[model samples]
Target: MPSRGSATTAVSGLVALAIAVGVVAMLSIGVGSRFIPPDSVLSALFSPGGGFYDNVIWELRIPRTVAGLVIGAALGLSGAVMQGLTRNPIADPGILGVHAGAAFGVVVAIYVFGLLDFRAHVGFAFAGAALVSAAVWLVGSRGRDGATPVKLALAGAAISAFIGSATSLVLYADSTAFDEFRFWSVGSLAGAKADLLLAAAPFLAGGALLAFGVIRGLNALSMGADVARSLGQRVRLVRGAAALAVVLLSGTAVAAVGPIGFVGLTVPHVARALAGPDHRRVLPYSALLGPLVLLGADIVGRVVAIPSEVQVGAITAAVGAPVFIWFVRRRTVREL
Candidate 1:
């Protein structure tokens, strides 16, 4: 249990992050190629009459903003849960092969089913991610140690590589699919629709619930598996639930906006720094900070290149790669 002072600080951080998310989301709506004034953006948001800017705000910006919020939260929370479960500071949702699996599914859908619609790819992506996650768990759990962090990491890496190769082969064979996949692979919130966000809502909600459910167990596990076992925590069950949550959250996010990396890999660490090691606070902080970082990245992507836009993934990579390198080089990276 966290001290009262720490809990209060965590709550305060969450509130601050929520405000940041709101500000960035508004920026996402207001700052585009044709910059709508703040007053105009507010009026359009409040009064959805038949104006051109209103259409742009309500029809275009709102959905993408919503997607950014949802996907960012999913990635952030999933990443936190993943690190907790694995006892690895750098463990991300992709470490379970969920991203690669989802990408492969999208590729296959494009080539075999002739499904080019972004909304239609959700089911295939979820299915692929779920299957790959299960396979990784099975492989990792086979040894006497029973899904140790190292084993799970190794299994996930192997499976991700295999899926990546398969995806490349399919893309190489079909130029049309490659063309479509290339854009999706890069990742952006430019074309996200309200319906697509709605389509992925249930899975995201379920995953978040599962993630919250395992927080106590995660906190216990953080003390070491032996300590956790002594404390009567069901380590295996917690790990399994965390894995499922990761698949649902990561897969749905990838399906919505393709695989936007580093949000997961980096956001949790920031949350931990803000809220202390207690996952009770860390999860919510991550949820809030994820959108803050992602929406900020999206806004930067929009502003940095005039008429032409950079993909959100590209912007995030530009920022996150250096942070990742710093993390790796740290003398004592905090493992929580």
Candidate 2:
């Protein structure tokens, strides 16, 4: 175990890093087009109608920054919880099919039912994520011992594949659906609307709160179910609640931002590397770091292609895939 002073220092370092990243994200948000300076950006944020510059900051930069903040938090927290739940540093919400399920749900809503707007799609996507999670839990928890980490991971993979295939089939069958789904499936935060943010806020907020509650339980669970149970933690309830929170967060993020990849996978590992293994620290670190990674990527996406922005999803994949490969390669083949 690490010394107490060391742990505090580690958390302080991560907090500082996250704040620095957030500032960079803010700078990036104003760096393009009109190229507003940091002072102007601050003025815009504080006094929205101060001048023409303020309008640009309020209308353009603010939305993008807010989107980044929300989506980043969602992915980061989801990833940390997933890692803790499965005891796998490699675990992520996207890889487990929650995002795919939500994407599929939205496709079905738009294509089959013709719900063309963002507002109509959120509920469908949320329901779909909940359904996929339910399926994963049912299949994973089949045996006497309850869902082993291996079983849960495998179940998630299988379900993700099935849902992904279904999404493809739906797209291939309908050109109109393909047209709409094409951009969304890649996961960009650029097109998000204020209404979409409002719709997703409650779910995301509730999920984040619930996740924080489970930090102690997750820390105990890290020592194995028997150990956690002996310590008076209700293992099943804790795990179940965490999983529900994951569904809410990932689903809402997916609905608002599409099935963006890597935020969940990469942030948790980064958080743990910085904050140590305790879930108390890990969860908060992931929440902060997740947004930093995402917003940084978003800024990169904006600048990389100039007028033609690279999608945030694509940028994350480009960056995350190699890191994910490294994570897997470095990880020992333990149960989680």
Candidate 3:
């Protein structure tokens, strides 16, 4: 049970994060190569069609902004769930082979089928993530113990390494893939389209729900599996469901936006610091904070490179790495 003061603080912090998300989102829409003034940006938002900056605002920036919000929230939730599930501070979908699977799928689509369409990449990448997720569960749950944290972690690491090597080999041989696929690999919101966002909405929503559903289980598990079991938590069920959420959330995000590594890795720590160790607070905080970080980095990416924008992924890494190092030095509060 949280004290009245702490609860009040959490609610205040959440409100602040929500405001920040909105401010950054507006910046994302307005502050691009050809900057639309705030008044015009607001006007365009109020009356979207046939505007002065219709092409840039509605077509390009809006889709990208929407993608950032959805993907950032998804990655944040997935990372929080992953860290709790594995009890590893650095864990994310990458630790579960889910990300490697998506990357491999994209690599195959480019190398094998010569498909360059971003839409096509989404389907292929999602399929790969699904397959790898199932494989990880099966391998992790081998024996009567059934998906212990150590077993799951080890399984994911091994599968990720294998898939990574295969992907590297393919990229090494195919120069066309090397050139074309590298763009997606680096992660960028420039590729986001309305169709892709529509396609991903269901998956993202489902993932968010699943992540929230297991928060109690995760909080229980944080006390150790034996203790969790003693407390009537269904350990295996929680682990499986959390892993599925990671696959749905991080998998789809990677498929959609390529791999923006730092959003998931770093956001949870910030959430924990702000919201404390309780996952009910941590997960929600992370979802908001994730988009705030990603979109802010994206806004920076837009400005720093005048005519040609830097990819959001690159900017996130550049920005997030320093913040993460600071967290490590400070030993700030963390969820896992």
Q: List the candidate 1 regions with Cα displacement exceeding 4 Å.
A: 1-5, 50-52, 326-332
lDDT of 1 by residue, 1-336 (tens): 866436567677778888889999999899888798898888898887966699889888889899889989998999999999898888998889898888888888899999988667778887888888888889988966577788999999999999999999999999999998888888798978988888889999999999999999889989988888899988788788988888888888887788898999888887776677888987998898888888889989988999989999999889888987786676335666
lDDT string, candidate 2, 1-336, tens digits: 866437668667776977786686777668765678777777766766756587666666778788888889888999889889888877877545687788888889988899777668778887888788788888887887676678888898898889989989989999888887776778887777676788789999999999999998898889999999999998888988888888888888887788788889888887776566888787888888888888888888888988778988999999989877787677722333
lDDT (0-100) at residue 2 of candidate 2?
A: 61
RMSD for all candidates, in order, please. 2.2, 2.4, 1.7
lDDT of 3 by residue, 141-203 (tens): 999878888898899889989999999999999898888778888888888999899999999
lDDT of each: 0.87, 0.81, 0.89
Candidate 2's TM-score reads 0.92
Give candidate 1's error at residue 150 in angstroms.
1.4
Ordered list by lDDT, greatest first = 3, 1, 2
Determine which window of 10 residues in candidate 3 has minimal summed lDDT.
1-10
Give the local distance difference test score of model 1.
0.87
Clashing pairs in 1: none
Question: Which runs in model 2 stand beyond 4 Å of their true positions?
Answer: 1-7, 326-336
- Candidate 1 at residue 136, lDDT? 86
Clash count, one per candidate: 0, 0, 0
Best by lDDT: 3
Best by TM-score: 3
